[model samples]
Target: MAPRPNIIRIGMLVYPGCLRSGAVMPFDVFHIANTLSGLRVAANRVHFDTCWLSARKEKTLTVGGLSFHPQPADLEALDALMLPGIDHQGPYDLSPLLLGLGPEQEMLRRYAQTGKPIISSCSSTCLVAEAGLLDGRRATTSWWLAAYFRKRFPAVTLDAEQLVVEDGNHVSSGGVTSYLDLALWLVGRFGGDALRQSTAKVLAMDANRSSQAPYIAAAMIQDEGHAVIERARRWLNQRLDRTWNMAELAAHCHTSPRTLLRRFQDAAGMSPTQYAQQLRVERAKALLESTKLSLEDITGRCGYEDVSTFSKVFKRWARITPREYRARFGLRQ
Candidate 1:
């Protein structure tokens, strides 16, 4: 028998004030991929060795109110180093952490020299910029901090409108939710589209939805109509497992069914029913990719009344059968 390939080691750097969402989201996504793949024989086995790297071994608090203790290792051994965002008030807010990052920065610089990937999200993009890794590179961050980032690092081109920006070995994403997009991209890059599709499916995300340009532009434009569309989207996202009808959705949005249909079409470029189905299909994809649950269970959980109907809808939307999609993207059962 052949020896198992080495698992990719991902080092997550958690500091005293790191954002919990930024640090934990990627970990959860990758772990789900590992779980789903392990259930089948032919699936590409992904071993994710996550170590929390800190300047000290003392207990640290996360911005989301979680406390953790990390290993004190030099960052050299990591296949990838993730710098989570911090809520820094100004330049002074980052000095302490930035001061101690010389060793970490050195490791990142060496990794860049060797063509390894370096990822940062939200305010963490500042760390990469400060390290001069993004000089003359296009990157992005949370819109609120875009101007400051451009001012602080004049050589780096900032695209505040993009959810995630990839420049060679460096990847940066906008806000907390955009971390999902960045994680999906990494899965696609290293693990292949099957893993990427599976991870996105598990997350209930739309792989067809470009994480860049028009989608981001649509998200940024906030008007009264946009607010209504957003409210409808939130309602749908929260009730993916429940059967949703056009009348019920219209009532929830305080409009007639026809008006709701027209507005939803204008806002999201799809009918409300179509939008709901899209969301369901996205959820179904995630379930298939991340869990060992039976097809029946996934269909029910994603609000399908019957497996036949569910399979048909999934195939129509995804352009492949669920089992085939799973086999292509996941390890064979």
Candidate 2:
């Protein structure tokens, strides 16, 4: 068994326009874990000592109407550092906002040199990457930002399919809501898996969920476009209800299979076949959410004749069965 600290003091960095949930939820989870510790008879139960911190922006840091007067940039006192998601309206607003995070970036660099734990979730991973902390490190961000992160931080190996990634003392997780996963992970890491389970049961979260694959969406499918790839995408969308081959798709786009493959690999970061699979998964998610169709019917509609095969394909991307997805996210009528 690893040596468990009696109390783990984590400092969550809060910046301007940061996602309030990212800051709030982790605190709530840690607080809840402390409450759960009261119920345990085990000796030396780990305690989480968490506080919100910033680079002293204001007497009170107010973002999205919530206010917090965080602690100072005292890196020596912290056992670990956490960064929560900052709000952004997709790709358009993302870059402009990052340009202003210079102070925050320097903070990461200073703390990173200490070689203690530094955790960043969602768009905060970009700040860490910008600070050059994630270079040659395995990290992840929101799956939608996979292409952008790769192009921007080529030195850092991006694995956007994971809910959380820990390389050395640096820990990173995906997207905005993954703070929940990050918080739960910290609980399990510093405390114990048994406590993590009891806390998760009380919190009503799926403790075993690890991969971000099932939540993958096609929103970023058109990010870096090639003319041939765009044409292929349009053609595929039109016939997603039918199976397709690369040769047929290339012909429709007036390109050879080899040309299409080259251009697609360059533009989409995956094969045309993989992109088509994403489209199918996205389509299946939509149908599952909005329609009450049977599994067999939905399978045929998504171009799979076999329901089992369709389930496998869907699970490959969405991480859950179509029925399970519908049960959780489907419309109630």
Candidate 3:
């Protein structure tokens, strides 16, 4: 028999006042990855050892109304360390849990110096940024803290719209949902595309699917012609479950279908139908992630009368089959 592949051990640092949502999000993704991959791969081929490295020895600490216990393990054993955001009124007001420069800090710093992968979500970026690990690297955090992050960490380049930014060994993401993106990206990196897709299907999430740049760039044109396109987007968002007609939409916007087509193409770089299809696909993806609805139900909800059509559109938009997508991102049935 062949030797087993080296297992990847991930350490999750749980400190007091940490955001429960952020911490739980990555844990859920990795947990699902382990379950799905472990069935096929040998126990030794793929395994996840999650340890809670905390400064204190308390069995339970309340964070966001939930209690958590720390694991007994040194940080040197982890291949990756995850830092979930904590609630702080300001950057200067550090969490009491992280006040001292003890073994936890030293271990993290050593991992950083050795080029080990570290992922931080939301305000957790501030912790690594303070350690000077993100200097001259591109990163992001919650959009609300973009200005503050930029002001405080002048050495790091801030990209506010990105779901996550990867700079060498350091990676950071914006807001809570971006944690899913980061976890999916990590899954793809460590477990291969099959495992990543399987995890995404379980969560019903679209991994790295859409590019917001085109939408933002078109919105920035700021002309009367662009107003019509903006109105169409708003209109589609509101009527995502209903079938859309170009002539009717044009009439509602007080323009001919030809004029509507011309303006929308110039502004959004896509036809109105194309844009509407994208919205429908996105809606389907959300339903897959947030609900226990069946694929046919999701297809109908996204305005696809035919299941085949919906599956094709979903695959085109997400680069994975709907069933595979759901399996990778959806909750276990």
Among these predicted structures, which one has the highest TM-score? Answer: 2
lDDT of 2 by residue, 1-333 (tens): 544548889899998978999988999999899988766765647789999889756779999889998877789888889998869877546777888988888888888888899989998898888888888889989888887778788999988888899999988898788898889888998878988898899899998877877677775635654578777778888888987787898889888898888887877778998888889888899899998998888888888889999898898788788888999889998
Residue-level lDDT of model 1, residues 148-213, one tens digit each, is: 565567799988667778888889988667777777776677676887788789889875443332
**lDDT of all the models against the reference?**
0.72, 0.85, 0.73
**Per-candidate alpha-carbon RMSD to the true structure:** 12.3, 3.1, 10.1
Ranking the candidates on lDDT from highest down gives 2, 3, 1
- TM-scores vs. true structure, each candidate: 0.57, 0.91, 0.58
> Which runs in model 2 stand beyond 4 Å of their true positions?
1-5, 224-226, 331-333
**Ten-residue stretch with the least lDDT total in model 1:** 214-223
> Model 3 misses residue 233 by how many Å?
24
**Model 3 residue 114 CA deviation in Å:** 3.2
* Residue 148 C-alpha lDDT in model 3: 59
Relative to the true structure, candidate 3 reaches a TM of: 0.58
Candidate with best lDDT: 2
